[model samples]
Target: MDALLILSGIVVAIIGWLWLVITSLRLPVGKLLLAALLPVLTLFRRDQGYARAPRLLLTAGCLTLLVGLAMLFHLHPHRFEKLVTGQWQPDQNRSQTIDGEIMGQRFRPERVFWRGDDLVLEEGPSERVRRSLKIRFAGAGALLDDASIALLPNDPGAWPEVIMQWHVGALESPGLRRVTGQYSLNLDFAPAANSGATLRLHLTLPSQHQTWITGEARLDQTPAWLEQVRQQQSRSTAVRERTATAPRQSGERPVARWQAISVLAVLDEPSVVGDAAVRVTTVSGRAHEGRFKGVTDEGRIVLAQAHGPNQVDLQFHPVDIRLLETFQSPR
Candidate 1:
């Protein structure tokens, strides 16, 4: 992707230069004369077998000159000044910070570190947010944007939660916003323990809002993932139990009570109410099932009485939505 983008940029630049040469006399005539002389000089070097080195050098010089001129006219003065002065400010659109520890598996057992800074944007009652981070591995050079990310409402009353999707090549160097890089493995908060494994993480959140939680974590016990699963299972089990005991009403079929069920997966999709679904499965063995209702005030699935002695009410937490989606998908 990087090569393709660079190639495309060069092509566009060449085309633009051709257009300018055809239409304008302002092309730096001195630079153009020097560019024109390089190839002629190459032809005189017969001992070098008329090697194309001169042409390559001339082409590079021409391209650099064109790009320099373009930047003079197109680049922002203030931004250029910052670049020259070696000082830059973080974009201040919206603000939030996340700090956390990240651990990964490896022989000789080592840990990776994580830190992030994010911008938040508000649209009337809604909010839009973006984040960037730096991550370091034990033996590897530092990697940025190593996943531990979340967007919560800065407004204490809302306490809204939104998980940002990880995209490769999202982090930017602090000195040059344009210099961006990619992340190799994007991980969420999940705990796992294994032989030949170790974990390390260091994170920084850039906002004034207080972060909800932070501490040492393993891949196996990611609190958010686990808590969400637990809530979904509890909700599903409660619904099943109520349905099992509910007496059948006239012309009504009793809902089946699922057995030894566990949440298998979840997905969050855009919705009028909210975006997410919870997928569940039985511990004994069976295909996964889905629960489509939104979360309740207490963070459980919302359920209504359908008839019989089993009818009950319920709600679920944000995690259930992801579990529901995964379970519903094949495998």
Candidate 2:
């Protein structure tokens, strides 16, 4: 803990001590400075000694010092501690925990620690053996994201991810269960004990609308992998902040969330450039077509233009629309 954080406690103690000396001992204003600077000298001043201070003032001073001392010891977690850690197991007991099937998973985590938008949780030594139902997470943003990509089948995203993998004895390996298909995800987070957090994840593949993972993960610890991830996220945030705030040179536009330009370059046919396209019609009955890229949070319609292998997204305000039609790829 930083001393600067608890510095006020120390200051309060000193101020309270001085106040007691002046009020209780009735020290002259001129001699108050001497007492404050060298409280040890009070022992020789019989009339001004602490023994003469008021009982109430003495008690208040002692309490202040005790409070300050406790703060100095830094008994709480650090400010940066934000990770959530704890045990993760299947809700097999039908305790009304949702798809809480498959009981008796990994041993309860030994510890959970969190720091700075990151968390780590490690199960009791049991996950080491060959038969435990183990689940591990490896992503930044204090939640799952695309970066946790692995070749494993259980995980998702544009690349490979290890989803549900089971290892058993040479001939006892069990077939993977409830682990198939791409999915859409939803998460609910709730605060837990010791500054930890509980993550409830629900996944369903759009095609089948079937649940893949209805599980809970509690995190509150420092993990080696998450440490690297946390540092990277911190550095990225610093860089982005600096870039957005740096002084702009002459003629440089201030940063904007979205922008448009004139004299746009030409592109290949929409079918050749992208897998999806939208034709938007204005109230005036005029239509414009382009590759569809969905709509932005600000209600701006996004279209894309392919320049060989590269692409750019174009935006349009929603007010301009009278109708819109779209075409999407099956793949």
Candidate 3:
């Protein structure tokens, strides 16, 4: 459907341009030929009278000329370039990445920004959830501005969601144009399971042309170790409360109580450091797997060092409310 819409739009634009040229150029040779051909063709077909034939043929010829010009000049070259290159190059000094977790699962790439290119995200990994992504102001052009990226879940009945937005510059010249925009990924995951996700990238140019690409990856799985730590913390907390309330027996050195409390607190702390195990995937499809240990604070997980070629320092934040709720809920 999208392809059809785009094709139709291009056709219409070309026709409009042809009309403009027909009126402005007013080529007598072309006009005369069209005027004569129309009446003859109409007479043979036994259709309309000779009068209307000339006007209809003239209109069609003009439209054809406009389309020819558009095709020859390729009004929107950037869009075509993207289709061939499959890479978006926005202006310099514009780059960003949005990171957040989906239900405590993993720090997924929520959005990526590079100048004016707005890359939309889509559903790719699991089937349990849907995500919408949008990117605004994809690339610079002569007269085009304002671009967007949208992601729809696999469910055919579901509606599309906007995930990114940015302003595009107008298309005016033929020189190298640049655009910058942010790519944002938005997902609504199922309560306790990992859901699949996808990202869609789009680049639009001045000539009303666009290029689309897609990338996909699974959300990181929550480490079972984290769950164990939480459970231990809960038990320790309960033990402390009971001990605190049980009025310390006459002089029973409060040392015992303090010892127990310390043990409990330690049990609840996460042992993984940014230097623990780390997994890295490069654009070349090569997997460099290692480990890195790091510390987490205020729901943000950060890596401190890389254990190998596949490991790198990265930060992740909890963004999945449902996952957090389930994790905290009594099992």
**Sort by TM-score, best first: what order?**
2, 3, 1
Candidate 1: give its CA RMSD in angstroms: 17.8
Cα-based TM-score, every candidate:
0.22, 0.29, 0.23
Find the candidate with the highest TM-score and give its number. Answer: 2
Per-residue lDDT of model 3, residues 126-214, tens digit only? 33112323433222221111111122223111122223221121243212222232222222111123432222232222222232333
lDDT of candidate 2 over 1-331, digit per residue (tens): 3344345545654665566556544556655665566654554566554544433343455455556444533332211121123223433443123242122232233333444333323322343422222233332222332112112223322321213333322334443443233443444344456654455544443333222345566655434444464456567657757866788799866553212211111122233323455655545443445677654456566565443443334455566566655544322
lDDT score for residue 182 of model 1: 24
Q: Candidate 3 local accuracy as lDDT?
A: 0.33
Per-candidate clashes come to 46, 20, 52
125: Cα error in model 1, Å:
33
* Candidate 2 TM-score, C-alpha based: 0.29
Query: Could you tell me how far off, in angstroms, the CA of residue 134 lies in candidate 3 after the best superposition?
Result: 21
**Which whole-number lDDT from 0 to 100 does residue 63 have in model 1?**
57
Q: Across residues 187-251, which tens digit of lDDT does each residue of candidate 1 receive?
A: 23332345211122222223322111232333322333334544565676777677668788897
Cα lDDT computed for each candidate against the true fold: 0.32, 0.42, 0.33
- What lDDT score goes with residue 17 in model 1? 45
